[model samples]
Target: MINEFIKNIKILQQLKDNNVYKKYIEYIRYPYFRNLAPDSKITFDFPVTFLVGKNGSGKSSTLQSLYGCPKGYSLGDYWFTTELDPIKEFDKNRNCFIYGHKNNGSVNEVIKQRIHRDKNPDYWETAKPIKRYGMSNSQRFSPIEKDVVYLDFRTELSAFDKFFHFLKFYSNTHKSKQDFLRFYTNKLKEAFDTNKIISYYTPNRNKPKVILTKAETKIVSEILRKEFESIEIIEHNLFKDWGTSIRLKQKNINYSEAFAGSGETAIVILVHKIFSASNESLILLDEPETSLHSGAQKRLMSFLIKECIKKKHQVVISTHSPFLIENMPNESIKVFSTLNTTGKFVIDNDRNYREAFHELEIENTNKKIILVEDKTAQILIDKTIEKLGKATQDIFVTKYLPGGADDINQRLTTIMEITDDTYVVFDGDQKKLQKPVDLNLMPPNQQDTSKKLKELIKSQTGCDVKFYLNGGDQSKELKEKESLKLAKKYLEFYKRNVFYLPLSIPEDIIWDKKFAKKLLKLMKPEKDFSLIKKTSSNSKELLFNFCIECYGDSDQYESTVLQFVSNWINKEDSNFRIVKDLINKLKN
Candidate 1:
C-alpha cells in the first residue's frame, strides 16, 4: 500500500526565494555562534514545508525568523513542530513571531502549548473586535464582518470539497430555510462534492461502520487517523455566505496552480483560516500535517506560495517530522545556521555555504570521523578555524553522548580500526571516571586546546597543569586530584540555573531521558519534572517506539543489517518506521 502511494506520488522541491527576516539594529558580524547550523538562518516562502537535518543544524530558526519575537529568531525544529509544514503563526500578544524551542531543545513544544494553540486559532470567530486578556482596541478582521460558519469535520467533510459548492449552488436556486432539505436534494441529484487530492480520506458518514469500521477495519481506521487528522471542508474563497457565513472562491494563482478550473476547497480554508486567525497577527504552528496527507503537502506548498502574492503575514513554528519536504524539489529547501539577529545564513541561496562547504568538497582525509559528545564544540573548532582560514577538510564532526567519553570510546573502537587526531571532551568525573581525561580514545580537540586550558587556569586560578609533569610548582595538586577539583568546578558551571548538557552524549539524546534525569538530579524531583525538556528516558523510549511505527528503520544506517533498528533513534520522517515496525514486530 505504502509502495503504491510512494509510486503514485513523487516529492519535488518547491523552491521559493524566501527573504529571511532580521532586525536592522542588532546585526552581528562575527557572532559567537555565527556558524551555528540550522538555528542561524531562517526563511519563509511556502504555506507548508518540511525541514530535515541533524540536530543543532538551525532547522527551527527558519520558523521563528520574524520580528517582534523576544530574541531574534534562530533555525530549528523541536519534537512536534509544524513550522516545517510551512504554516506560520505569531503570538496572540502581537509580540514578535516565534517558533519552537531553542536549537538545543526537545522536539515537541507546541504539544506542550496545547491551550495556547487553541486560543488564537478560534480568534477569527469574533469579528467585531473581541479582545483577549491582554489586548488594545485596535485589532479586528474587518469592519462589519458578514458571516461565520464553523465547518465541523464530522458530517461536513465526508462530502469533500464540492460538498460546500453544492450548498452555495443549491442556495442560489431554493432560497428557503431548508439546509437539510437542500443537502438531501443535492445528494438525490448525485451532486456529491469531492476532494481530488485527499479523497481517499473522504468519509461516507458519521457512523463508524459507514466509512471506517473500528471493529472490522481497525487498521484502515488507524491509517485514516494518521493521515486525515480531521477533514473539515469549505466551498469558496471567501468566508461566510450571508453576514459573512462562509464564502469560497478560487484565485487565478491559487494554491494548486495545476488544478485551474476550481481550487481545492481545502486551499481556500487555509487562506481564510490564516486570515481569520489574528490581526496584526503572529501565528505559531506545529507541523501542518493535520487534515493533509503527503500528497497534499506538495499541493499546499505550491498553492500557499502565492498567499504572499497579496498579504505578508509573519509566522513562526517548529517541525522535526517532515512529510512535506519528502514531496518538495531538491533545490527549493534551504538550510539555516542560527536564530540570533545577526548570525543567520541560508544554505541554498548563500553562495558561501554551498560553494565553501559543498563545492570545494573538503577531503575526507580524516574520513574516519570523530563523533564528539556535542560535536558542536568540535564543529565550532572546525568551522571557527575555517573562518580563521584553516583547511578543516579532514575533520568531520559527528556525535558522542553528553558526559559519555566511555561510550564514545567504546563505539569508536567498534567503527574505526585506526584513530587519527581524534578528540573527546570528558567531565573528568573522579568517582565516575579516572583522570584529566576520562576513558578517552582520543584527546580533546587538540593539544593546543589542552595547552590553552593550562594557560587559562594559570591566569585565572593560579594553577598550572604543566606543574605536575614539568615540576614547576610545589604547591599545585597532582593531575588526577586537580582534575577532580576542576571537574567539580566545571560541573558547577554546567549545573547552573539552567543545565547545559555536557559533550560525549548522543545527539538525539542530548535532550533525551538522561537530560530529564539531569534536571531532576539538579533540582527537586517533582518541581524539576516540568522544567526538564520533554525528553526524559521514558519519553525518549516512547518517541522512539512511535518513530519506528510511522517510518521503517531501514534509513537508520547505510551499511548495517540492523539499519531498521538503528533507524529507531532518528526523527527524520513522519512515516516513521520504528513505531510501525515495533508494533508489527510485537504482534508477530
Candidate 2:
C-alpha cells in the first residue's frame, strides 16, 4: 500500500558552502524545518492521503517532493522553502506517481508537456563515461510499476479518443483492448444495468460510413451519456487521424468537441479513465477540487475512497481545497506551511488536525470567546472559571478559540476587536514554577490548602507529600523513587478530573508526549501546586489535573486565587508579575 510504503519525511537544508548545487547536508532545524518541525514524522496511514495548506506553505512542494523523490525541485527553490530538502522514504514497494496541479488550467498544461517531450534522444557518440551534474530539469514521472497510475484533473477526451481508435487499428496483436472493454462494460453494467450498446449515425448522410462495429460506436455514446444526460452521442469517425470525432445531439441540435463545455468534456474523459483503470494502482490526483464543483468533488472523493477500500488501491492528493482535506483523516492530512516569524517549511500535523476538526465543525465555540493555545488550556480555563464562580458575564457565556499560543498573540488585536472580554491563556510553558504554592502569601484561612491537598494525595496513593517532593527516603527510594512514576500517578489523578468534567486533551499535547513527560519531570520535584495559574503576559495557564483534583472544595481555593490575582493586577505591579500589565489594561 502507498501509505505503508512512504514511511517518513526528513527535511534537509542546503549547506552554506557547498560544491554541489543540490547537495543538502545540514538539517533545517529540529521542531521546525521550514513550516513544519524537522523532527515531525509524517506517515501515510490511510488508503487516501491528502496534502493541504495555504499557497506557498509547501503543500505543493511537499507533493512535488514525494513525486520527485531522490532528485527534483531544490529545497530552496520553493517560495516557502528558504532552506529545506523535504526527503520522502518508501517501504519495500516504492510504487507511486505524481500528477501535477490540475484544474481548468492543467488539462492544457498536461497535454502541452506530453506534446513537447523529446520523443527521441541522441545516442552517446563515444563510449566514454558521462558526467551528469547539477539539479536536472524538473520532470514529473513516477516509477514504471504496474501498481502506479499518475492522473491529473487534465484528462483530455482526445487522448481517450486516440487510445480507443489505436486499439481498433491494431486490434489483432493485443488482447488489452478486450480487457478495457470488459472493464468499462462491467462498471457500466453495475451502474446502469444495461448490456446492450447505444450507437448513432448522422441522419443527413445518404449512407453514413460506419467504420466501427455497432458495439464500439454504442460504447462511446453510452460512456459519454452518463456524464452529459442532456446530450446523446450522434456519430463518431474511427479511422480519422484525429482518432474519434464525436458528435452529440442535444435538444435536437448537433454539437461537437468545440461546442461542448469544458466541464462536461472533462467529466466524460475522467469517468472513462476511472472506471477502466486496473485495481490496486496508486492514483495521484492534483487539485480535483479546482476542476470539479463542490458536489462533484464530494461524490468523486466518496467513490474513490470506497473503491480504494474495496480494491486495496491507494490515492494521494495535493489540494488547497478544504472540501477535500476536511473529509480525510487527520493522520492522512499533511499540512505544509511557514511557521510564524521564521521563514521555514513546517510540516504541521497539529494544525492539520485542526483543519480536519474544523471541516466537521467540531471545533468548540461559544457566544463569547476566550482565545487559548489549544484544547488543554481551554479545558483548564473553563473548569477553573466555573470553580471560581466569578459571576462575570464572560465566564458563563464564552467559547474557547483554540488557536495556538503564537497565533493568539499575533492576532490578539483582531480578537480584541471582536470582543473586549476576550482573554488569552496557555499551558504553563513560560517558565518553571518553584514551590508554586507560596506559603507566606496564603491567607490565614487558606493556609491549610496545601496541607489538605497533600493529605488528599496521600489518601489516594498512600504516599506522603515528602515522598513526591523529595523522591522518598533512602529506604523507600529503591521501592519507588522515580519522579516520572510519581508524576504519572499524580497526573492520572488530575487527568481523571478532566474526563469526569468531560474535557478532552488536544492532539497537540497527545502528539508530543515527550514535552508533557519532560514537563512532569521538571515539576515533580519543584513542589509546584497542582492548581491552575495564569502565569505570563501570554496568559499562560499552568495547571495539573492532580492539583485541581486534590481540593475537597475547589471553589473556595479557586475564588481565593482569582481574587489574589485580580488584586495584584489592580495594583499594576511592574516589579515581578508579568501578566499584570495585560490584565491591568483589560481592567481599565
Candidate 3:
C-alpha cells in the first residue's frame, strides 16, 4: 500500500533558503501546488487512485509533489515535506520510488534512499547525521529497505543498449526457452526496482553476441502477440562484437520500433514494464489513456487493475478520461479544478447530483444548459430551439437534463452551482391547476380515478403511463387533462405533415417516402373512438382519443409527433421564436 511508503504530504511555507514565496502562498504559482489545504492528507484507500483535473489544474504538479522528486535531481523551484515510514529495527535506511515524465521528454523511474543519522529520530534536532543510503550512481543493488520506483511510458522503452545486453546474458545462460523467459522476467523486475542503477562492466572493443534458439524467439513472439494482435518476433540477431537485437514482424512486413506505430510500441513497452514490476510496487501512471483508442484504453485499464490487485501493487493515475473515471468507487476519485482565483480546489465526487450532470459531460464553460422532464420534452425543446436559426453554434451551446418537473429543483440547484447560464424548461402542461389542491398527499377520489386512467391508458395507448405520471401531481382530473392534451398535440403534429401515414400499408411496399408515411399511419385502427366524459377541456381529450383509435397506441402517436417536430425543426421554420425568447429571458 502507498501508505506504507508515504503517510502524508505537507506543502511548506518556504524553501530551505527562507526566501519570500510569491505564488503558492500569495498568488497562483508554478510547479503545480497552489493554495493547498494545510496539512493536506491523501490516503491510499484503494489499490488505484486517480487524479483528474483540467489543463493547468495541477495534476502533474500534484504527482510531482507527492512522489516525483528524485533524491539528487533538481525539481526546479518547489518545496514540500513528507512523512515516511520509520526505518525498521534491523534496517539502516528507507527508500521511496517515483515514476514520472522527465524534462528530457522521456519517462524515468527513480529510487531514492534515505538514511537516518540520529539514533533517536523521534526528538527534534538542530543537525543530524544523514547520507544517501543507496549504492553509488554506478553501482546497482536490490533495495534492502523502503524503496520507490517511478515508472513512465518513455522509461519502459529506454536504455536500449542495457536492455539488449541484459537479454543477451539471460538468453546465453539458459538453454531452455521457458527458463530463459522466467529468468528474463525476474531480471527485468530487478531493473525496474533498482531503476537500472546496478553496475555494468565497460564493453570490450569486441562485444560478444548470443543467438536465441527458435523456441526462445517463439516465446518472445507469443508474449508480444498477446498485446498486439498478429505481431510476432521474427528473429534474434547476435553480432560478434555487437550487443543482442530482435526483429519483429507485422502484417507480413519486418519492422523495428523506428518503423512501427508509436502507439502500439508504447503500449507494448509500458505493459511489459508493468508486468516486470515487483509486487507491492507503487505505480504512478501519468496518463495511460495517451496514445490509445477508447477500446484499447479501457482494456489496458482493466488489465492493469486486475494485475495490480493480484500482485498487491498500488496504482495512481492522473488523467482526463471519463471512460477511466466512470464506474469506479466514488471515494477513490479526487477531482481537481482551478475554479477559485486564489488556487485550485477539489470537488466531491460522491454527490449524486454531480453524477447526474456528469453523465452529460458538463464542463466549465459558457455553454447554456436546458433541464427538461423526459425524452419527449427533450425532443420538443431541442426541436423548438433548433428552429431559431443556428441552434448549437451560438455564443453558448445548450444541453438538457433528463429529469422531469419534480427534479427541476434539485437539477437547478446542482446546475446553477456549477454555472450561472442555465434554463429550466418544464412542459407546457405543467402549468398550475385551475384550482389548487393538496399535492403532498394522494386524494381518495383521485386515487380511484388514477386506477381507471391507468387501465384506460394501457388499453387505449398500449404504452406504460408510469413514465408520464412520474413526478407529476397524482390528481386525477389534472393528470388526465395533461395526458389528453399531450396526446392531442402529438396528433396535431402528425396531421400537419402532408405525408402522415394512414391505417395500414402493404407489407412489400418499398420503404420510400410513400411507404414511410403509410407505415406511420398503420399504427392506428380504422374506426374513430370517443370518450363520453364531460369536462371543460373535452376537445383536447376527444382529439387525443380519435388519434389513439387510428393509431392503436398513444406511444406511436407520440413518436410520430417527435418525428414531425424533428423534421420541422431541421428544415426552414419560424415557430421556435417563442422558445428562443423564453431562453433569452431565462438567461437574463
Candidate 4:
C-alpha cells in the first residue's frame, strides 16, 4: 500500500524540482485594510497561514476579503452568484484565485467543480449556477459540440420529460439534499445493494501489486483506454445489472432494491475530485477531523502530506490538534489569534518549548571550576573563554541541573563527590549575596545590610538586587562607599520566554565589585580555623588568589616574605636533610 502510494505520487510529480516551480504560485492574498485591524498586518515564518477567530471576529470575512467573488470565483460548485465586482479593487491586480464556497473545497472537490463548470461555462458564466437555483436535466451543453456524461440519481428530477442531471437540483439556488447529510455518513454502512469488483493489495516479494478479478480488470481496461494497451484494475469484482437492478457477483449480495446510498456516492465523487486535481491545485481542507477517529485522522493527514509533497501540490490545513502539528517543523507553523481588541500577535515559531528549570550548586573545591546556569550561558562561557585566549577544556565548566535553589545544593553534592575543583558564580542581591540565602536575607529588624554597612557606602542608591558575575576570589576590593543599581531591561529579552515576557525570579541577578570581593573574604575561616601545616599544593595561582583575597592589605612585606619563604621550603627537599647531617658530623 505504501509503495503504491509512493509510485502513484512519483509518476505524477517527478519533474524534479522544476515541476514544483509552477506550483510556487501562491494564491493571492489581496492586501486590503481590514476593519479587524486598524493598520495593515504583516506576518511571517510560515508559508501557509490559517485564520481562526471567533464568529464575527472576521474569520470568514477575512477569507472573503482576500478572494474575489468573480462569477467563476467560488468556494465550491454548489453556489450561485451574479454580483459583478461589488467593489472595483482589481484594476491593479496581477494574479489571484478565489473560488466559491458552500460546498467543501479540496483538490477532489475542486476538480469535479472544474469539470462540471467547464461544460456549463455559458450557464455558469452568465447565470452563475453556483447559487442560481441552477437548471438540471435536459440542459444540453451550450455550443452543443462537447460531450458530457452526467451520472446523477433519478430522484433529483421532479418531472418526466425534463432531463435528470446533477443531484438535488431542486432550485435555482441550493435546496439541501437529505442524502448527503452528516448523520447518514457515519453508519459505517456500505451504500450499494450492489455488485462490484473488490480491489485489494498484495505484496510481490517486497514491492506492492494491485490484485483484481477478471470482471474488474475488464471494466477498468474498458474505461481507461488512454495509457494501457492492457490495463489492470486493483479491485476483485464487477458490477452487473440484474432485472433492472444492480447486484454484486459475490454471494449474500442481493439487495432487495439495488441502488447505492448517498454516502458511498459521495465518497466516489470525492475521490474522483482529489485524483483529478492531484496534479495541480492548492487544496484547502477545513475540519477534516469531523467524523474521523484519531487513528483515521492521523492516517488521513499522513496520506495528504505524502500526496502533497509527491505530487508537488500546495496544501493548507487548519487544525487545533497538537498531534497534527507534531510532525511539522516549528517555523512552518504559525498561530493566528488576537490577544487584544486591537492587535494579534503571531507566533511564527512552532517548535518552542518551555525551558526546564535548574540552578547551579556552589561548594568549596581544591581546584578551580566554573559553572553556568543555562545552555545559552554555557555556550557563552565556552565561546567567551575561547575568545579570551583560554581553551574551553582547560577551564572545567559545567551547567547546573534545572529546578529551584534546592536543585543547586543537590547538584553540588553530585559534583563534589566527583571532583575537588569547582566554583559557582551567579547573581543575587547587590549587597553581596551568600549561599542558601541572598544578601536580601536579613535580620528581623529589616534594618538591611546596606543600612548598617552605610559606613562602607559611597553611593547608596543602587538597586535592591543585581547580577554579579565574579571570578578569581583574589579581588576582595569592595569600595567602602557604594550601592548596586537595579536594572529591569536585561531580563525582558530572554528569547525563550513563551510570550516574550519577563520571568519573576527572586532578585534578578544584580552586580557590584563588592560581590566579587565577598567570596574571597568568605573563604577565610574563623581565627580558630586550622591552616595547613607544610601545605604542598602545586596550584600556586589559586593559593595566591586566596591569600590576596583574605589578607590583600595585610603586611605587604609579610605577604612578599610568605611567597619567597614558601618557595624556599619547597626547594629544601633533600638539601634540608643534608644540612642536618653536615651539622651532626661537625659536632662529632
Tens-digit lDDT track for model 2 on 1-588? 224212211000111122111211111112222244344444454546776655565555444333332222222222221126423323321111222221232210110010111432211111111112111334433322223444445333442344454435344434676555444333322222232232323222111222333433343334232212232222222222222233344344544444443344444444444555676555667665543433345445555654554455556787755545543446567666556776665564544544543332222234333455554444434444444345533433323444444444334322222234444444445212222333346465643344444454444323443321211111233323343344333333322211111112322222222333344455464434323223312122232342333343444434423433333333433321333232233333
After TM-score superposition, the amount by which residue 500's alpha carbon in candidate 3 deviates from its true location, in angstroms, is 28
Clashes of 3: 20
**Candidate order by decreasing TM-score:** 3, 2, 4, 1
Sorted on lDDT, best first, the list reads 3, 2, 4, 1
Q: Which of candidates 1 and 2 is the stronger one according to TM-score?
A: 2
Q: Where does model 3 exceed 4 Å of error?
A: 1-39, 68-247, 347-588
- lDDT string, candidate 3, 388-424, tens digits: 4474436444454444454453233223324555444
Q: Model 2, which residues run further than 4 Å from truth? A: 1-40, 69-147, 151-261, 350-588
Error of 2 at 87 (Å): 15
Which run of 10 residues does model 1 get worst, by summed lDDT?
A: 22-31
Q: lDDT of each model, Cα atoms only? A: 0.30, 0.37, 0.40, 0.30
Residue 311 Cα positional deviation in candidate 4, in Å, after optimal superposition: 2.0
- The CA root-mean-square deviation of candidate 4, after full C-alpha superposition on the true structure, stands at 28.0
Error of 3 at 189 (Å): 25
Candidate 3 versus the native: TM-score?
A: 0.36
Off by over 4 Å in 1: 1-48, 52-318, 321-328, 331-336, 339-368, 374-395, 398-588
TM-score of 2: 0.33
Error of 2 at 279 (Å): 2.4
Model 1 root-mean-square deviation: 25.9
What would the per-residue lDDT of candidate 4 be over residues 315-410, giving only the tens digit for each residue? 454443333443343443434445465564322223321110111123223324555443323332333344334433454444543443333423
